[model samples]
Target: MRLETEMNMLQAKIQAGIVKDETVGNTSRFSDANPNLPHFQDDLDIWLTRSERFAESKNWSRDKWSSSLSALLTGRALDCYGRLSSEQAQDYDKVKQALMKRYD
Candidate 1:
């Protein structure tokens, strides 16, 4: 059948490296929307706003926000995150408050 032949040709192309078969599971929907937290900027307020928006857009839980923000933090912001107690670090509001206090 024509469909079977086309499928075989597609498989052959993939095997030969002529085509890249990127399936849904292997491709990230957010690849193009990669968000980077602003680092060491005077505009901490703006950075926090953008981070919140990014988390919301991704449908990430509030519980996940602190760790995610910590991972993207750099320079003094990273230091601020590091100085938090383990329990405080787990709370996004605590992390945000710490960062604000550090920068303020």
Candidate 2:
């Protein structure tokens, strides 16, 4: 009975995205600095919204929506980085690298 209980608990944790061997230490640093980091669904929503807005405003065909959204997001990212202070941007890059390494 005790063994069965432990197995059920382990399965529940794995289903909840908490794999025991996934990380050596806390993985909160990535989420801490960039609280708005895009998850899978968030990315999809961002692209969809951008495409919808572009098509509505410019009367663009559905086929052009993807290209328009890609350009807009790229421009927006560049603009945001351009507005950041050099030191702050560098620090952001370092944090980003650390986060990537954590996943790797």
Worst 10 residues of 2 by lDDT: 31-40
The TM-scores of all predictions, comma-separated, are 0.61, 0.24
TM-score of 1: 0.61
Q: Please provide, for model 1 over 56-76, each residue's C-alpha lDDT reduced to its tens digit, 9 standing for 90 to 100.
A: 987876876775565556667
Q: After TM-score superposition, what is the CA distance of residue 84 in candidate 1 from its true location, in Å?
A: 0.5
Backbone clashes (count) for model 1:
0
Q: Which has the greatest lDDT?
A: 1
TM-score of 2: 0.24
- Scored against the true structure, residue 74 in model 2 reaches a CA lDDT of 27
CA lDDT of every candidate: 0.63, 0.36
Candidate 1: stretches off by over 4 Å = 1-40
Candidate 1 lDDT (Cα, 0 to 1): 0.63
For candidate 1, give the lDDT of residue 46. Answer: 88
Which residue pairs does candidate 2 place in steric collision?
none
Task: Give lDDT: candidate 1, residue 48.
Answer: 92
